[model samples]
Target: MAMNDGMSGPGSNSLKGITFLLVDRNEALLRSFQETLASYGAAVYSVCDISKVKDVFKEVKVDVFLADMEATGQETSALIRSFRDSNPGGSFFLLIDRVTYKDALSLIGPEADDYFFKPLDPDRFAQTIETALGQSRPKSNSLAVIEPYVEQLKPYLIFRSPEMKQVLMNLPRIAASNQTVLISGETGTGKEIVARAIHVLSRRAEGNFVAVNCGAIPDSLMEGELFGHEKGAFTGAHKTHRGKFELADNGTLLLDEIGDMPLSLQVKLLRVLEEGVIYRLGGERPTAVNVRILAATRIDLIK
Candidate 1:
């Protein structure tokens, strides 16, 4: 049976375990929202201080961020833009009064996945978050893409090989601690599967997981794909966006084919790991994230 850790608050249904960050300038509304979220089993962090909002996010694992669009339209947009730039892969919900819905959408644009009108519909709001979470859920089981017997070294993988066994034994120990694990193995040897296994057994098992192929993206766009780009950062960058690092902030990020990563990009990636933060492709502010990294490569990293 699944053990209940009672993170839910009043009025929270079975979906209370998901974490949501509520950012509003109004203290009263923030508390009310927190209470509602807690009742349903959610881990809530209410932030009324605009100055500390980003700081709070750096430390907490927020599944969905709900921001008030009325707090200084220009500053709010900039804040939202910064949030998107830093967390390229995370999801967000916007809260706007009925009068400002159109303007908010026009200003925030595509970066806003869903919006909530004032005099909110609790049932519908809950449903929307649930659906968004469901749609973005990564395929956890090994058989998601590969057949049960493929023996493929991918998402869900199995191996009885001696080298593989050594990796498996060390996985739990590695996953339980915070360490940078470099998975070096031959192709088709299930390197990615080893990464997935580590994530599954780790403390962040319930959070989202994202996988990116360092070798697949072009050298020019690799940073944007991994860290994200701000609107007008480049000619085609029409709007603010989040990248994989931000998306997988509280979860795991599987870096496949790390050996093929360009030298320049390697420097950037190393900095992110070392600095424990990231800046958007065109932006200068760094965003902190909590992500378990699992990298797979078919070549010798040191060579």
Candidate 2:
């Protein structure tokens, strides 16, 4: 039986950057899953030939393995067993056709990380895959956290002046915390470098480090650039964009040239910082984000 949601969004929300190996007997179904999921920033590779599973696993860094198995339970179990032997860290999900849903439950529910019934909800299916992958994700090596920072920030952390020394000394504590940082320095003083150093030391080191020049963007499009815009928010907005804040979710966002930011946007910026949410241009609902903000300014705004 053919099942599909047909040109809909991901089976779940936020499939961005997820890589998976999708296995199913139905060639067309696999292709559809690949196209639909890939359209939403997911890395999906369709595997119609189950016998090629070993070969596929060898080539892909698969985060999740989703198989549609209407075949014998014995074959399904054997394949899963072999898959686990090769990629134990990979998340597994079973897709059972409605007719065989009941019979497959016993094999799928316990052994697999998760299961989806036929006629899968694009959103729900996406959510299940994401959730299982997250749960089964390998724990990052704690010791390795400092390794990256040392390599990236070595050049910037070197300065003989007392003031620079103080800044470098306190950097680790600053980076370890989620507090908003205000960096003040003239142009060519490496303000952005400092911001990157802070991000490297933070838990968000693995996440995105987005920096935007507040003065570079025109006043007309500043808000839209910072907070994103809905499709048709304004002229030429063909599709919705995930602004710096959204792109930096669970990460660090550096708003450089803060002193040059227009007063009107500054007020809105403060509100977003306080509320931890932003309303996209021409959007009805406010989108929430968890972003570490780093602001840079050279001029004193006290006057």
Which number leads on TM-score? 2
lDDT of each: 0.66, 0.70
Tens-digit lDDT track of model 1 for 129-207: 5433432353443322222113322446454666654565455445543345788878887777778776765556677
Runs off by more than 4 Å, candidate 2: 1-149
Q: Per-prediction count of colliding residue pairs?
A: 19, 3
Give the top-scoring candidate (lDDT).
Answer: 2
| TM-score of every candidate | 0.49, 0.50
